[model samples]
Target: MKLLNVSAGKIQTVEIGGEKVRTAHVKMPRPEPWIITPDGAEGDERASHPDKLYAFARTGYGHWQAQLGVAPGEWNDGFFGENLTFDGLDETDIRVGDEFMLGEDVRLFVSGARTPCIKLAWRLNQPRDFLKTFAASRHTGVYLGVLDPGTVKPGDRLERVVHDPGMPSIADVCDYVAGVQAPVELMRRLLAFERLSPTLRILLGARLNAAEAAERAGRHHWTGWRDFRIGRIVEETPEIRSVSLSPLDEGPLCLPQPGQFVSVRMADPSGDMIQRVWSLSSYAAGMDSYRLSIRRQQGPGSNWIHRAQAGDTVQLKAPAGSFVLDPGSYHPVVLVAAGIGITPLMAMLEAHLARENAPAPVHLIYGARRPGDAAFLGELLALAAARDDFTLTQVYSQADAGDWPRSRITAGIVKESVRDTYIALDGRRIPVPWYESDIYLCGPGDFCDALRDELVELGGQPGHIFSERFEAAGMAPGEIEEAEVRFVRSGTAAHWSARSGETLLDLAERAGVAVSSDCRAGACLTCRTPVTGGKVTADLGDGSALLCIGRPATPIIELDC
Candidate 1:
């Protein structure tokens, strides 16, 4: 099929349904060859939907003209706002897994059908029912995902290099979007495709039912507390130790996604139960055991953990966190961490390297106080030595004569490392642009916030960066006016300092009242407690407070502890 036109649009104010709105829906054909990247057309401006990058097939312009009785001149090559308008290949003809070479070097894969939105109706000056009509017909064009990045121009022929007949066609997806019922097996097979757009995946999953879909997405793992025996412990550094855990029942634990953490419950020196969280550092694609890399701190809970033996048992809930890697991403991965924050990023690096077909490069920029304090230094160096795709940059704040650069990790170090990074693709070294790569930042709050601001100033995409900061340290006791706190369920009344910044969970422990908590941060909702009589600093949408981090905002408060 020959490429008819190439289009790109910018954000502009336009009239939509008698109201002015800012949108990039109207695209004008460009004369020069357009650069195609993983993010889509080089100059195209997109809205909230990032998944639908490029669109194909304006061959249905004739069909639209006949159906809507519109003038022939009204439909141009890019009237549908598609990036690359082509002929001959339409929704019905393209399968989800179909791969094609656009022009010479550009490779495009069929991801899904273009799901019409209100913007489409607005652009065409038609009623909202136009979206329904567009979806009902097979005239809906197929959306293309960039596989091999290159340049595309008008008059370039679209050559189909690969096609799998077993996969569902783009038309089938459009039909499903229009609320047509399909066989369960067909829907399952559609959902199985890795390249399918996430939006369409959710839609199909809803049609198939939520439970089965959640299971497919690895969200139905076991929850709540279970007994785990410490399998082994290794001292990674002078202050950081790695503890391996296995199910006491000898059953397999569900393999955790890289970058997840498990919450542990154990007794402190005072014989009182305390909960804490640590990031998992080891991942091997199996579920036989899990490992946590804990940094020794001044807290009693941490001291107890460091003193525990291998045979000891701790109550642990299933691994949970949103700061995990994107398995489907085809972009370069850059991991930045400091001190104990290296724990989760370590898991992410190892997991990415273990992939059978890791297409992109992975770079890690880590910092520590000194060589003695860096966790897994030997392992990181060994990986860098063993793999050509891996790059490591270590900066020590308290570096000696042996350490290179001998300075603290700064935004310049990160930006320069990524700026010079390259990925080996098809025997060619392609520079990994900071704007396109997926960057993960984990460290103290101030560290993350400062680096993020600097990176944004230096032309980094804020959305492409993901960060998880260390939990805020507990407040220290100080002199302040005492406030009355009442535990409604336990019938216990205690005095708490309003200015002390202590959480309700801490007050409960001091008052000899029992409360369940995990993470000791606002993350896990295990410490959810209802605020019965007064205001709290933290509130979940259900009017309950996260007792682990929630404090009394008022002079006096009551909690259902």
Candidate 2:
């Protein structure tokens, strides 16, 4: 590929799509004889960063002209915010770790595809849907890291110095980023490339691990209702126990993603099968069995599980849940847990630390009624001691003199934990902005809802804050008020009472109306159904109703279920 033009830009504010955006590379001009450094172009704003110090290269203007169906000169170099425009090499020809010789001395290593953000849509003055179309086109261009720094001018010849055949092409990376599912083998190959972006590698690695777990489970044909023998049970706290189980046939079991859960079915005294979903607390990698930390509740499910002994067999479904860590996100993580909610968060912590070149630091805030109620106190302390990037803060609502201060995990506590500056374990003050971190909340419904609402009130985006509750956490539907819900596709209607404490999906199931669902939480969109008529209230705001998490706001609701 021949370098047709080189460009750079300084930080400036520009108006795009009627919005003012401050960006350093708003309009990169073609600079002649650009000086290249190990960080990036000498005058470029994106230089000398560990993750994004590289330059971006896009195809020539002609390629965009044809793809966008625009007139000649309508779009030119730097329109897509690229630092370098090349004539010959397209995104399809570039692979992670492929090195290119620029001019006589400069070398650039292909890192990964540039992910399109809202800024690009604004820059193009296109509708929000254009972002989707742009990504689906697989022409987002590629990012290059400076391997051997030197100087280069316009018209410099670009030659391939090295190529790794095993690496996925830039197009493949784009496809993966766009939510296209890839085979396990392809994901593994992508993870093998060292020069690949850490974000993408971590993402691919997670996918590979999940796929391997599924493969192991599939080997034993373990699907639907299967018998799992209780392998071991250990008391975690005075009221909590960690139960380990393995397939009855002694076959390999699929490891669940951190924060995922499995449904366990046990026969009650009345000979009726009772099922309960519990979070898997243990890490998934290289695991032969599944482990769940259960708090002894008064419910029949928990009571039976606690009474079970080793060598006892119970029926269970394969592990599944949508409340999983986003492997693609590089932001720091804040895991908030209260009481037994620590189960899933512990799994997430383990998974994050086990990753190669772990992407971001983790801050864990856990609270319980007392020190004796903390389930994984020893394990969490050990993990905090081992990893410098991990910070643990414990809160006890009812603590003795020797225990932690009697402080409940409230909005105030959360705010303090995410402050801009905090004293580190080594006594050094560090600046860590909590708003930039992804916060995961798992605990009692009321506790989680209160914290989630508080975070949003504190300017936290709903999308960045993930939550999972063991039971319904919202306000109780006072006094029985019957509401009629009509399913358009199924031609079935059902009457639901606000006091029933049932979601739209629950009402549908009771009325024998079929609706697709997974996760049962609002995280997965599988249960999202359009509301053709009437109105419904939901914790999520995606225009459509998440049946699993939605309740009728109006007396008569129409669903396209």
Candidate 3:
């Protein structure tokens, strides 16, 4: 491998999304013989103290540019916050435990792949969708651990001193990090790699244990589809409505835990079936029906649901999601929501209140553009008034005249809410210490990310916070490249292009191909299928792609459909 460029920089403050954040080398320059250490380049800063030496690489930039139709010189070296840009090195060929001799004496060991964070998107001035795109691209560079810290410079020829044949490639490790389900043996092999970070090892071990437990439990996985009838429809707001559903067969409905979502399928104006997922907004231990509160958006699915009346029939699948309350924990809970995001959190709050024993105190901070846009406000207010364990803080971003304070939910507001000894709800001051609470965030992706970063800055444990997105956020239009998709099982092929603006599922359906799918948003993993050849970009990082949110990145994509 030939080192093309070496760069380093100290932490500097930059304004992003109207807030100042500390970032390193937004525009790093190639430096000659830069000092290298176990932590990182001498001047670089990262949260991980003495590990995760290298930040990023430029190996995949060429592929990204070709796929995205970006012009030359539109992006430069260090654009991805990477310290190293190399030539003639295949990123996929590098494996964990591979030792490289840098310059004459400096030795570096491959540790792991660089996990893309929100900051990288901010640095690139890309939209939020860029995060998923980068992960799907699988070119996120690699991290290195210094075995013999020394000076390394541009034009330094890198010689491989060692390679572990049993180890997985950085791409494989990245796939695992992106929520790909690995085989038990693969997990064990990764855990045994001595050069792997301790934190990563622990995570792999946990995943292995969980997979084993699930296998032993013999849990019956839900497949196929079921039918439901809308029992009631209530207008919650001018643009939002709550639909109550019941099984058509009069059988028992599947009980979903709080914060879980169910997939709903309906026909569009052209009679093409469209599938969308909505969170269960209310929870009753033995209820016979499920409630989904939906806000009308520009999409056809939401608009159709908004116009539907009671007694309308729809197809639905079982609830599937990992975003749920920790039943074993007794920690105080803080639920944060914006606009219609209050649905799932409401279910969680109700579940907590229904506990037989004394439950931990629950606080909710909800925001909306106006008082009229807030859904379930009356029910939430009544619940808070009736229970001492429940408290609510309402924030409106565009309220003209209101009794409540008008403010946007930000990191500052979250920190202030947590530090206060008592929470102010309406005119009542409820004594509650929220600093020690576990946080649950739901809303637009950008809003949730900002709140999460703030909470972490205020000493909140990253693991203690949970979040879910209402929809695939930041769907922006861009140039699309022409491609071909081949279905292995069906012995058929279809043409696709960026201008089609349709998911693989939609394309397949139009081409008379049958693929089982439920939630098309990449959350439920219902449309997951392996790509045997070529490349495809998706919203999620698993080895398989969600056809609902997947697009071709190469000239030809072969799917094991």
Candidate 4:
């Protein structure tokens, strides 16, 4: 490929969305040869994009000029803000990690595709939808990293010195970023690129996670939902109830990984379908049925569950969650729980006891309001009585005189237990220290947070501590205000509030509106929706918003869905 021009730009002020911002998106051809360095070409402003050293590509200027009806002499070389405008370098022809020698002096590696954003639209004086058009064109150009920097002048020949066919092409990377589904194997290959750009690596990783998730969803035992008969209901406590269920079709049930939960879908009193997740409380090793422990909370889902009886059927999805025990680790286990949080820990403890191999020593620190408030108290005590390696400490905040431990669980109590507890190993008893154990915490948000901080302060490794809470992790706090959200295509509307702490995607699910979403944290723009009216707090460059993280910032919001 021959370099047509060498362009560099100074930072300039531009207006976007009624705000003046400094950008370096405009470039002019230099009169003489430019000195290249490890950072970038000399005299070029690159602070706005530090992840990449330079942008270089053949911008298809003639094609776009004709398509957009630009007059002659307009849309010149380097008009797309590329530093080195090339004559014949196509995005589809080059792969990441491809090395090229320019004029036999400067060496650079193709990093990844230059992702188009709103700045591209502003620089071209086009509408916001131009971002999508540019991306769909798959001619977004390539970003480069300097390898052996030297002098490079206009009309310099760019000779390809290296090419790896196994690596993803620049066009492939652009397609992946443009919401096109890539095969799992291709994504894996992209992730394995040794010299891949950091920004592309992160994006590929999130896409790989989302792709694998979709594959797992397709591999689920049942699609949509399946009916499960309620075998029995046992009142573990006045507030907690355990229901055993088996598939009505008599098909084998996929055993849940210890600490995993399943979604139960049923109709409420109003005959509206609703779904709730409940942790599996039974040992999965030899289980013929699934047992879900539910607390009688003041909600439509819980109320319907409490009012249900045996012989009734409910729709169940396959078990899911990453909170399972580390079966491969031999580290001593510390299971801490409060209230209904004990359900998952109970599964872990029981699964450990049922293991054919020698299990790791476990210590359960359970807390409740009082002795009667603790579900599975008798069952846990029986297991502890039967095993010397398994230890149980019951902490009750309002325990009576007859209760064994009559105080709330604190860091002090945990420290004392860490010093006192012992594990039997090879006919010897060794003290189980906090730092050496893998601590699993589950409970209310505040309880888990406080305990996690205290444990970290007590010299416990933060990575050794894993936690699960009642709400979604990484949820951000926002002002509580009621708002109306309308999904135009679905013809559905719902009342929303920061008080519910639900994203628009979550609201769409509850409102029975189907919205395509993957990686529901806004990393992938699969859930991006057009905002026809009203307002939302988002980070989109265009007039669209990502429903996964976008929250209503106005009293009424309308989405094209």
TM-score per candidate, in order?
A: 0.62, 0.68, 0.53, 0.50
The 10 consecutive residues of candidate 4 with the worst lDDT sum are 423-432
- State each candidate's clash count: 0, 0, 0, 0
Off by over 4 Å in 1: 1-220, 400-404, 420-430, 473-545, 555-561
Cα lDDT tens digits for candidate 1, 170-229: 888788777687678888888798888755664565566533322443743676888998
RMSD list, candidates in order: 10.7, 7.5, 14.9, 16.5
Q: Which runs of model 4 end up more than 4 angstroms from their true locations?
A: 1-220, 400-405, 420-432, 472-503, 506-551, 554-561
Task: Pick out the ten consecutive residues of candidate 1 with the lowest summed lDDT.
Answer: 472-481
Model 3 scores worst on lDDT over the 10 consecutive residues at 423-432
Pairs in steric clash, model 4: none
**What digit string (tens of lDDT, one per residue) describes model 3 on residues 1-561?**
777776666666765544444556464665555777766676666432224455454546777677768876687776766677776555678887899898987888887776554467766667544765676566877778888878877778878889977788877877776667778898888767777754355345556755654463234334667888998899999998999998887877656777888888988778898878899999876767889999999988898899898988888878767777654444567889988889999888987787544235777888999878989989988998999878787888987424356788876666555544332322344333344467899998778888898877765657778988766622233234888899999899999978778888898888888987757776656677888887667734455777888888778889888
lDDT of 2 by residue, 337-364 (tens): 9999899998998887776555457888
Ranking by TM-score: 2, 1, 3, 4
- Please report the TM-score between candidate 1 and the true structure: 0.62
Q: Model 3 clash pairs?
A: none
- The 10 consecutive residues of candidate 2 with the worst lDDT sum are 421-430
